[model samples]
Target: MKKTTETLRGNYFFKQDELIYVNRNDENFVGPFHDHDFLEIAYIVEGEGFHHIGESVQKVRKGELFYLPIGISHVFRPKSTSGQKLVVINCLFSPNLLPKLIAFASEKPTVDFLWRMRDGLLSNYSVRDRNDRFERLFQSMFEQYSTRAPGCEDMLHALLFQLMVELHRSMRESENTDQSLPKEAAFQDLLHYLRNNCEQELTLSHLAHLSGFSERHLQRLFHQHTGQSWFKYWQSVRVRRSSELLLRTSDKIQHIAEAVGYKDIHSFNAVFKRLTGLTPSQYRKRE
Candidate 1:
C-alpha cells in the first residue's frame, strides 16, 4: 500500500539558493515521477525500497544514497506489501553554488561523468555503513538541522563540499564514460548576461547578440545542449528569483513580479501558474 502527502505544500521553502527538508516516512509510500531544477540527494536512513531514476530502476536500502541532477525525473517507493520506515534528507542546491568544483574539472572529463550519473549510475557505497565518513557527515548535517545553532550555514557548506568530493570520486570510478566537453566558455558568457541584466527586458536576439551567435543558431545550440529554449530558460531563472522574494520578503506580488523582469502582474500570474500550477497568491498561501 502506498500513500502520498504534499509535504512542502508548495515550493516556498526554497526561494533563495536552496532548501533542505528531512522527511521520515513510517508507512508504505510511493511518489509519482517528478523533477525539479535544483540538485537532489536522497539518503535512505532505514528500510528497503525501489528507486526509479530516469529509465533505470534499482533497489535502495538503508545507508544508500541517490543523487539526481537538475531536471532528472525520479521516483521511489517501498518494495513490500507491508509498510516501511525511512528517513530521507532532501537537498536542493543551485548549480551556480559550486563554480569552483565545476571549473576544476576539465570540461570533457566532467561532462561525461555528469551525463552518466544522470543516467542512473549507482555506486557501491552504502548509506547504512555507519563507519563510512560520508555517513558521519550526513549525521552531522542532520544534527545541524536539529539544533539550528549559530554557524549552521557554514557547517552545512563544509558538509556539502565533502559530499561533492565523494560523489566526484565515485563518478571517476565509473566505466564507459562519455568525456566530451560542453561549450562551457559560451555557457559562462550566457550566465553572466542573465545574471547582470535579469532586470532588463531580455530577448533571444539580445542574448544572441551578446553571445556573438546568430539568433537562429543560438536557439538551436541552446536547445540541443541545455534542453530548453532561450525564452523558457530565462523565464525559469526569473521564476526562481521571484520564488525567493515570495518566501523571504513581504513585497507585493506585482512588485516581486516586476523585480523579476515582468512589467505586468497578469503576465507573471500566467507564467507562475504554468510553471508551478499555482497563482502567486495561491503560492503565497502555501507558504
Candidate 2:
C-alpha cells in the first residue's frame, strides 16, 4: 500500500460509507496489524509475500485472493530480501449494504460459499488465464474495476457475483473444504441486537443477558469473532452513527450525542475527538 506521504496521480475513489484503494507497494514495507469496521478483500495483482492473518500465516503470490473478516486484526508485507511487487485492490463495505439473503448466508458456508467468500481462505487459482473460461470472468471484473462507468454499482455487483461463483467452483473442486466455523450465526444475532438497541442505555450485563451468555463469556466471544471488546465495538457503532448524523442532518451536537446514547455532551465531544481527530462542529463543517 502507498504511504500517506505518497501523491496519488489517478482519480482514486471512494463510495458513500465505503472505500476502495488501488495502489502499488515496494519491497520491505510492513503495515501494522489493525482491524476496522468494514470487510476487506485484497487481490494480489502481482508479487509474492507472506500474509499474516489471525493465527494463520501463508505465502501469497500473484492471482491469489485474501479475505479479511470485518474487525479481524491482520497484516501483509514483503517477507524476503528480494522483496516483491504488489498491485493491491482493497474494498471495504458496511454489512448493512449487503442484501438480506447474502447477509444470512454469510453464516453458513453451505449457503454462503455460493454467494460470498469468508475470511481466512486462500486459493491458488490462476485468474490470469482464460483457458477454462474462468479467467474471462476475472478479466471482466478487472475491466469493470479498472474502468468504472455510469451505473458502475450494477457492474460491481455482477463482478462480485462472478467472483463468488468462481470461488464456489474452486471450493467444490477441492472437495468442499470446510475451514470456517459456525459461530457466525450467534455473532450475527448479537450484532443485530446491538444495532437495534444502540440508542438505548446498554451495559455489559444487559448485553450479556440479552445474548444468552455471561458477561465474561460474551466478552470472550466478541473478542474472538470481532477482535475487539464489546465496549469498543459499541463505541465504533456510536461514532459511525454520529458521523452520519453530523454529515447529513442539522441536528445539534448535543442532540446527536444523546441520540447515540451519550448523556454527557462533554464526554461525547471528548470521545468523538479522540476517535475522529475533530470536534463535532468541525466534523460537520468539513463534511
Per-candidate TM-scores read 0.45, 0.43
| Each candidate structure's count of clashing pairs | 5, 0
lDDT for each residue of candidate 1 in 38-154, tens digit (9 for 90 to 100): 566777766777876667678877777767666566677677765555455555555555553444446565555544443446332323332244556677777876687998766
What's the lDDT of the predicted structure labeled candidate 1? Answer: 0.65
Residue-level lDDT for 248 in candidate 2 = 90
On the 0 to 100 scale, the lDDT of residue 136 in model 2 is 45
- For model 1, what is the error of residue 163's alpha carbon versus the real structure, in angstroms, after optimal superposition? 0.5
Summarize candidate 2's per-residue lDDT along 148-194 as a digit string, tens digits: 77776566665565555555555454464454322444456678677
